[model samples]
Target: MFKAVINVNYKPSVLDPQAEAIHKALGRLGDDNIATVMVGKYFELTLNAPTIEAANDQVERICDQLLANVNMETYRFTVTPLQGATA
Candidate 1:
């Protein structure tokens, strides 16, 4: 089996109000060292694929179809083999 870790975030051009609020709150809490804050979604998925290529394909399709907004958000993922697991 393979494990996929996916992260979805807004594009650079898009405004992230939640992140902005967190940044401002951090500053109010005396966190001046922080330059910026970004909010995103993370997902962990297990797939019964035989190969890394197949796992990657599945992750891509999932992210493209359901997890991310193609117009406003972008996504990235990593696929790894699970220890002692079979497809």
Candidate 2:
């Protein structure tokens, strides 16, 4: 078995309204030192793949096809073997 950790976020050129709102809120709360706020999505998935390479391929496909908006958002993921887990 394998475990995949995925993160999806808006591209640098894209405007993130949620992040902007959080930044403004932080300033209102007296946290002026914060330079920026980025909001993103995180997902943890377990796969029945027998190899790390297979797990990675599955994660990439999942991210591209479903988890991320390719036009405005980018994604990254890490796949690791699950300890003592069966496929």
Number of the top lDDT candidate: 1
User: What TM-score do all the candidates reach, one by one?
Assistant: 0.95, 0.95
Tell me model 2's lDDT, rounded to 2 decimals.
Answer: 0.92
lDDT of candidate 1 over 1-87, digit per residue (tens): 999999999999999999999999999999978997889999999999988999999899999999999899999999999999966
Candidate 1 structure lDDT: 0.93
Report how far residue 58 has shifted in candidate 2, in Å.
0.8
Residue range with the least summed lDDT across 10 consecutive positions in model 2: 78-87
> lDDT per prediction?
0.93, 0.92
lDDT of 2 at 2: 92
lDDT of 1 at 19: 96
Could you tell me which residue pairs clash in candidate 1? none
